[model samples]
Target: NLNGNDLAATVGRVQLAKLESIIAGRRRVAARIARGLADCDGLDIGHEPEGAESVYWFLRIAVAEGAFSLSKVEIAAAVSAEGIPVNPTYRHLPAEAEWFRERKVFPPSDYPWGLPDYAGDRDAVYPCDNAVAAVESHFILSIHESWSDADVDDAVAALRKVADAYRA
Candidate 1:
């Protein structure tokens, strides 16, 4: 049955990329960003450099699909997913995209996908992913940023340390 005047074609089902798996990763990115901002260490963005190395992409999925945001519980999931500890929440705001946005920031899309380096190269005022890349790539973070990283593995160890401490 044709809804409009169109040529006949073979019948087939539409296929979508497994964005869910990629979406899951975004949660981790969000948590990581939130934690980094909340963390007192003051580590610069791009801790994982190339993008979410130690973090679990699925963490983002949980928050995106679940009730609470990336809280301590979500972080625990990230830890467990990453083979760390088994907690139910994140250290800081796991999927608290709004908070970050208020501060002119944004959260990752959740995983299987990947987080963008939003902050350009101007250095963050309070620690954040590359806003330039983040906004340009997704808009999870804000726009008035001067941070950027071709890769996000700049400082993973420190982020791991923060991710480890979270117990919820």
Candidate 2:
């Protein structure tokens, strides 16, 4: 797929040269934030798997329904109000997507994949109750290599504040 722009190519090359260092910086910041929130209940912060290393594209947290009095939606708002760049990673798609706004049902010839001759039900429901619930409870934190230690600390503090306010 054609995805690059000529101007971006030049900048990308420069960034590529320092990619390893940038990744390291992000990891450091992520680790610090994780450690800061290690004791907090109800929050499941993202972490690197067994032997794999990540570039920290984005930081995410899962809210445990048993531990938190507030919902993921409420936590996101509380954190956002604290001036952090955190947002709910999950949301209801049919309510948010423009395509779904116009077409309430999915199936035979209703979407792009639906063909004219397809003998399928037009109002078929996609079974994904678990997936929908998971997405609705994930909170994403915006992180980057450019952020300073203070920034990470601030994010940690914001999370703690929200957790304290809504402990179950």
Candidate 3:
């Protein structure tokens, strides 16, 4: 039986020691950007739920439905073009992955899509899929533990610029 890999274990131990500081840095950067964007419009900044605290690794933002004419992909592309590390993190199933492709089974006994009779509504599937809905609506901005306040400001500024330019 494999217990664990020694090197991986060692690295995990080291990272665990620094975990608190790492989380703090992430939260600090996220909070700064949150404050900067508080009064801003046309975009919805990521937020924590009532009791949950987020150590935001990638500060996620959702472009409001009517806030801009651009789609999520376009918004992500624009943000990336601005030199900020931003990406749309989610990809819808089947359309984005071959494993989910129609009528493709790895083994005859097991169809990954399951029996056709069990298949649900295809048209309504994407919107109802949580992963699809999330990716369709939001883009993620990478944040680092070492980022300065100016870095946070600059990132937020670029986002605001894109939002304003694309605003409906």
Candidate 4:
């Protein structure tokens, strides 16, 4: 787990500034955050030969836009139970869930949320399936397709507020 100082070490003084750039939606600045995030290859979230860099970009933007963290499993479970389809990709994961517990990390949920009946098995595991990615896609699409920027902001605000209100 990355304590504040540990994270600080990995993220560095300049890196937090980069993260701040991501928060502010300067694409150039967000690129720095992405690079820093890439440093933690231990997490396996950084690799994607696919279009997922854009996905990462959206996540940075969304978080910058007001989104914050939830317990990854909780988020995955919520999205999965929402009929959004979950892929439990923990199999063959480089690190076990225990490794991530140090950081309270949520493993990613995979793409193509709201799977069809036949596709659940196909889409339900990591290496190919991811839980964080699933929840992220669902909400990002929700923001992109049906909402205004103000609506997206309100929604991000609402998500954070709801999470905060439920804090134990």
Which ranges of candidate 2 are over 4 A from the true structure?
90-133
Assess each prediction's global lDDT (C-alpha) against the native. 0.34, 0.78, 0.77, 0.38
TM-score for predicted model 4 compared with the true structure: 0.25
The order by descending lDDT is 2, 3, 4, 1
What does candidate 2's lDDT look like per residue over 1-168, in tens digits?
Answer: 159898889888898899999999888988888888889988867645699877777787778876777778788889999998887874656644645544535643356336677676655556667666767668888898888888888989989989988898
Root-mean-square deviation of every model: 19.6, 4.6, 5.0, 19.5
- Compare candidates 3 and 4 on TM-score and give the better one: 3
At residue 159, candidate 2 shows an lDDT of: 90
Ranking by TM-score: 3, 2, 4, 1
**What is candidate 3's TM-score against the reference?**
0.74
lDDT of 1 at 97: 50
The best candidate in terms of TM-score: 3
Best by lDDT: 2
Distance from true location, Cα of 158 in model 4, Å: 1.8
- Locate the minimum summed-lDDT window of 10 residues in model 3: 121-130
TM-score of 1: 0.20
- TM-score per candidate: 0.20, 0.73, 0.74, 0.25
**Model 4 residue 57 distance off true place after TM-score fit, in angstroms:** 10
Error of 4 at 92 (Å): 12
Q: In angstroms, give how far residue 75 of model 3 lies from its true place.
A: 1.3
